[model samples]
Target: MTAYVGKRLAQAVLVLWAAYTLSFVLLSALPGDSVHNRIANPEAQISPEEAKVMLAYYGLDRPLAEQYLHALGGVFRGEFGYSLSSGDSVGHLITSALPSTLQLTGLGLVFGVLFAGVVAVLINYGRWRWLRSLVTAVPSLFASVPTFVVGIVALQYLSFRLRLIPSVDDGTVRALIAPAATLGLVVAAPLAQVLATSMRATRRQPFVHVLQAKGAGEGYIFRQDVLRNSSLPVLTLLGLAVGELIAGSVVTESVYARAGIGQLTVSAVNTQDLPVVQGVVLLSTAAYVVVNLVVDLVYPLVDPRILVEGRSRRSARWRTDGQAVESAADLPAGSARRLPAEVAMP
Candidate 1:
């Protein structure tokens, strides 16, 4: 078990290193220097010497390879670079924006799970076949609508037109609803579909049929067999849905003008803020990788078969403290055989 975890942890480190390297390469390829763009305002008339000093201050004056090595080393040492655009540490910027995005995704996932689970369970009840089909169709509509469009529509109708909530602020939680709901809808749709299909499949399995024939109550079968068997697929879909939630909310955040990581990413890209862009991209990618790793680790807990498989490949050893006894009566003086005399006697 320890060896398996060590291997997975090593693999996770390699994956994160590769992702960070990839982010650096992609950001490096973007046109223009980070400091150049920031100080290029015609009205400001920034001099060449000042620009050079700013570039040097952010390490942009160094070769790309050197800068990358430094950045990678800094990451390992718990240091993030200074932002060329904001003159603030990249770490600080990410820390400031991290909470809102976490709150949004976390709450959105909760709502999505509850919505999906309840709808799926109720819909799959055989008595409501027509209603089940109709409810199942709700996910299709959600899948069809783009997240950005949902954000716009939500803000327009729910916030602006209906006056249900206020329209713009970075400080309060009220500003989170429109964007979170927009993203939640997309996540809920597929989760519901997957859960409903899994539940139906579980209901048809032989164990469930056997339980039904043996006079077991529907609730008993559902609790003991159906839901248990259905959880693997549902959990797998949840991981994928979480990825979709993050990706979808990028646009939703922009549309709602929220100061989350997504909005920060967009601003970083538009202005070609390399440090800020790399910082945000690395932070978001780290989040994605961590979420996936957590999901991977959780799968075995949900299914003991996985734990068995993980252990079966390894060699097991046992130690004994005393000489072997040939017969129950002939056993060593201090050791008593637990087996019956008829069985242990030779």
Candidate 2:
């Protein structure tokens, strides 16, 4: 267990390191510096000398290697630097926007999982192959509909046309419903598809057949035996869904005019705010790593066979001397050193 945990932590560190390095490299590769965007405005008519000064001020004149090293050093020293466009600390901006993003991600995941599970159960209960195909087809079709389209359509129908919620600037939980539902539906689609497939596969497992033969009800076998065994693949899919949620929210945030990290990221990129962009990239990467790590840890618990195998292998290794040690429970009852009655007789 210690070894497994240590290995996962090490992998997480490496993932974050790679994220930072890649963000730095990509930001460096974008043509032109931040200063150019400001001085290049034809209406502003800023002189060449002023542009040069602005460039130097922002350290654009420094070698790329030095700039990257300086930025990295700042990160290590707990200074994320300021956005070139907004004149705000990148860290501060991220902190302010993080709550909204986390809220969106969390809500979307919880509802998505529940919706998928319910849909899978209903589909299985129906037990009609044609109905299953039609139900399964909904998720695939919904998955194909881009998140942006969903957000827009939800805004149009639910918020505007139906007046189910306020359309603009309501700034209430009620206002969040349309966007969150849209995002959740998009997430639920893939999850439902995966769940349906996994549940069907679990139903065909030999143990499920054994359970059914033993007079277990379909619900009992499915809920007590099959679902637990089949959940690992569902977890892996959920982790991927988390990554998709973050990636897909960029468009969703824009459509909904939400003040989440996705919106911040779009603004940062549009204005060439390298510091803010890098910060957002790092934040998203950390989120992905944490989500995947959680899924990996949950694997052992959902599938106890992993730990059982480990213990079995360890016990085998411990008994390498070839001397059989009889467990006390294996001793004959009523002997001087008789085993406990439960194990010895029963």
Candidate 3:
């Protein structure tokens, strides 16, 4: 387990480093930067000498290699300098905006999970075959539509026509409904697709048929046998969904005009506020890495086949002979193994 955790941690760190480096390289390659833009603004009237000093202070006057190294070191020390457009510390700008984005993400995830759960359940257990077929098609429809369109349509109908939710953010729960639901729909599409596929596959396994033949109730079999077996892949999907959530937030925040990291990101990028932009990218990359790392660590706990002894399921002998096929090394010495019930359908 420790070794598995260490490996995942290393991979997370590598991903963060790669994302930071790639973003910096790409942003540096851009035609001009915030300093240049600001200097060109006649309204600010920043003199040539002042401009030179500003460039040097921000390390823009240095070679790209030196600047990259300095910025990388600064990130290591939690130093992101200042935002060119706002003239505030980049950290302060992000910190101020972080809470709103976090709230949006939490609410969006909740709504998304609920949507996916309902869809998955209906696909698996709906009374009418046509209803299940219709439910299955919903995910593809969701996946085909862009998130912003959903937000716009929801805004038009829910806020404009029906007045069910406030169109603008007033720092109230009523203000959050449309945007959260839009983001949730985007999240639900892929999650529901994957979950429904897994659940249906699990339904066809031999053990499920065995349970049914033994007169197990449908509700009991579905709850105890089917749900647990199909949950592992969905847990993995949730980790990957963090990326989608962050990406979707940019459009969602813009549509709803919410003050958040997403809005901050949009402003920073538009003005070419490199420091703030890089800070946001780095923060987002770190978040993505951390969530995936946590998921990797949790996988062993959720699925016994993922042996914490660093053995892959492919390596383990899978004996479904009503016996515990897991290694004795994974258990306390001399401990009696408790074999779990085998219930799958063919």
Candidate 4:
């Protein structure tokens, strides 16, 4: 288990490094420097020489390799540099915006899991076959709809027409409803689909039949066996859904006018603020890696078979080594084990 965790951590670091390098390269390739972007205002007119000086001041005139090394070092020290557009510390900007994004992610994940769980239960455990089929199909339909479209529809209907919630920028819990639901519905679709399929397969397994033969009730068997077995896949999907949540947040926050890392990212891109953009990308990559690492660590807890599988592999290796040793011992002291005669060394 320790070795597995160490391996995963190493892989996570490599992934983060790759993401950072790619983001830096792409941002550097973008036309116009921060100075050019800032000097675009006619009232704040600046000459080409002045722009050159500004670039040099910001160390943008350095070689690409030097700049990359400096940026990487800054990241390790939690120094994200200054935002070219706002003149704010990139680290400060990210920290300020991170809480909102975290809240949105948490709410969306909770809502999605609850929605998927309810739908899966109705589809698998309910009596009406037609209704169950309809419930099963809903997730696919929801999955097809883009999160932005959902956010727009929710704003139009739930907030404006129905008056069920406040406007998107109202800065209240009620304002979170539309955007959270938009993201939740998008993520819930795939989760529910996977879970429903897993549940159906679990129900058909021989153990379920054995439970039935033992006179166990349907509810008992479902609660004790089916749900537990089906949960491993669901847990995996939940980890993967973090990416979806992050992607969806960019659109959802834009539509809802929320202050978050998503909004920060968009603004940084529009202004070509390389440092802030790189910071956001790095932060997102870290979040993804950390979430997946947690999922890997928790996997053995969910299914002991994972640990057992590792043990089985080790046991097999040990058995092979023992057999080789015994064969060596059985051979005469001065003789070597026979090798295939196909092409023995000349």
Candidate 5:
């Protein structure tokens, strides 16, 4: 366990570093940098001496190698440099804007999980064939609808037509609902799709038939056996969805006129604020890495069998006579464990 955790942490660090380095290189390769763009602006009307000093201050006068090293060092020191347009510390701007984004992300993730769980359960277990078919199609429809479109419709109807909740310039929780729901729906679509598929496959396992013959109701069987067994794939999909969630938050924030990392990202890109842009990139990368790291750690808890993959055959043996092994209690009772558990007893 210690080795696994340490390995995941190391990989996370490597990913973060790679993301930062790539972003810096790409931003540097842009036609003109923030410093030149700012100094060249006719409105600034700066003299040659001031321009020279500005270049020096931003380290544009230094070699690319030196600049990269300096920026990398500053990152190590917890300094994200400065925003070219506002001349404010990039770290400070990110710190200030982080709260709103965090609030939205957290709310979005919670709503997403709830919505996805309901949809997945309904998809696999609905009594009526028509209802099951309809529920199955819902994920596809959700996948087709973009976050911006959802946000627009919600904003117009909820805020303008109905006036049910404040959408603009309202700092309260009421204002958060529209955008967070938009992001949540986006997050829920893929999750529901993956979870439903997993559940469907898991339903075909032989143990489910035995449970049915034993008079286990559908709901009881699903809750007691299928849900837990199938959730490993859902956990994996959830980790991958972090990227989609963040991306959707950007558009959602824009449509709802919410202040957050998304808005900050739009402004930075429009003005070519390289430092702020890089900071956002790094922040998003860190979020993705951290979520996946947590997912990796959770694998063992979900199914200890996960820890068995990609290593030498374990130093363990399965019980020939099953007396309710906690993990495989639902699999079979009074059955000898075969090499792959595929043996059929006559």
Candidate 6:
């Protein structure tokens, strides 16, 4: 387990580095420097020498390789550098915006998992065929809909038409409902699909049959056996869903006009703020890596067989050797008894 954790941590560092490198390359390839983006108005133009000085100030005049090395070093030192557009520390901007994104992500993940689990249970365990089919199809329907579309629909119906929630940003929990639900439903769709499929497969396993033969109720069997067995794959899918959640947040935040990493991302992209963009990408990659690391750590606990099966195999090998030795010793005197293959081999 310790070795596994260390390996995962090492891999996570590599992932973060890769994300930084890729973002740096892509952002650097874009036409025009931060100076042009910052100085948007042609009417308020500066001299060519002044533009050169500005580019030099931001170290943009350096070779790409040098800039990349500097950026890599800065990341390791927890210095994300200054935002080209705002002249504020990229780290500071990210920190300021992180809380809202975290809140939305947490809430959306919780709600999505709950919603998916409920829908999966109803669809799989319920008796009505029509209802089951309908519920099963709902996830596919939701999955087909984009997050932006869902957000807009929710805003129109829930906020504007029904007036159930605030029409615009109020920075209140009530204001979070539409955006959270939009993100949650998008996350929930694939989760529900995978979970329902896993549950169906688990139900067909021999243990489930044994439980039924023991006169266990369906609910008890499902709760104790089916759900637990089915959860491993679902947990894996949930870990993978973190990326989807982050991607969806961009659209949801834009629609809701919420202040978050998503909104910060949009602003950075529009202004070609390379440092801020790199910072956000690095942060997002870290979040994904951490979440998957947690899932890896939790996996053995959920399925003890993962840990025990290796030990059992080693013990079985030892027992086989002992049995071969015993069989060799018990050979009849002068009876020409052939030794077992295992004992004769060595």
Model 6 Cα lDDT, one tens digit per residue, 63-116: 999999998998889898998988899999999999999888889998899889
* Superposition TM-score, candidate 5 onto the true structure: 0.89
lDDT of 4 by residue, 29-104 (tens): 8888666767676778888788788787677889999999988898888888888877789999999999888888
Candidate 3's error at 100, in angstroms? 0.7
**Model 5 Cα lDDT, one tens digit per residue, 129-159:** 9999899888888889988888889988999
TM-score of each: 0.84, 0.84, 0.88, 0.89, 0.89, 0.87
Supply the TM-score for candidate 3.
Answer: 0.88
lDDT of 3: 0.87
Lowest lDDT sum, 10 consecutive residues, model 4, at 316-325
The residue-by-residue lDDT of candidate 3 on 74-156, one tens digit each, is: 99999988988768999999999999999888899899999999999999999999999999899999899999999999899
Could you give candidate 1's per-residue lDDT for residues 85-116 as a string of tens digits?
A: 77788899889988888888887888788888
Better of 3 and 5 by lDDT: 3
Q: In angstroms, how far off is 190's CA in candidate 6? A: 1.2
Candidate 1's error at 56, in angstroms? 1.5
**lDDT of each candidate versus the true structure:** 0.76, 0.79, 0.87, 0.85, 0.86, 0.84
RMSD of 6: 6.7
- Candidate 2, position 131, lDDT: 80
Comparing 2 and 5 on TM-score, the stronger one: 5
Q: Model 5 lDDT vs. the true structure?
A: 0.86
Off by over 4 Å in 2: 40-53, 127-130, 308-346
What's model 6's lDDT at 148?
87
Model 2, span 159-245: residue lDDT tens: 778988777635788877667777787678878877877888889988888888889998788779778877887899887887788
Cα lDDT for residue 322, model 6? Answer: 33
Candidate 1 has what TM-score?
Answer: 0.84
Q: How close is candidate 2 to the true structure, as a TM-score?
A: 0.84
RMSD of each: 8.8, 7.9, 7.2, 6.8, 7.3, 6.7
lDDT of 4 at 69: 96
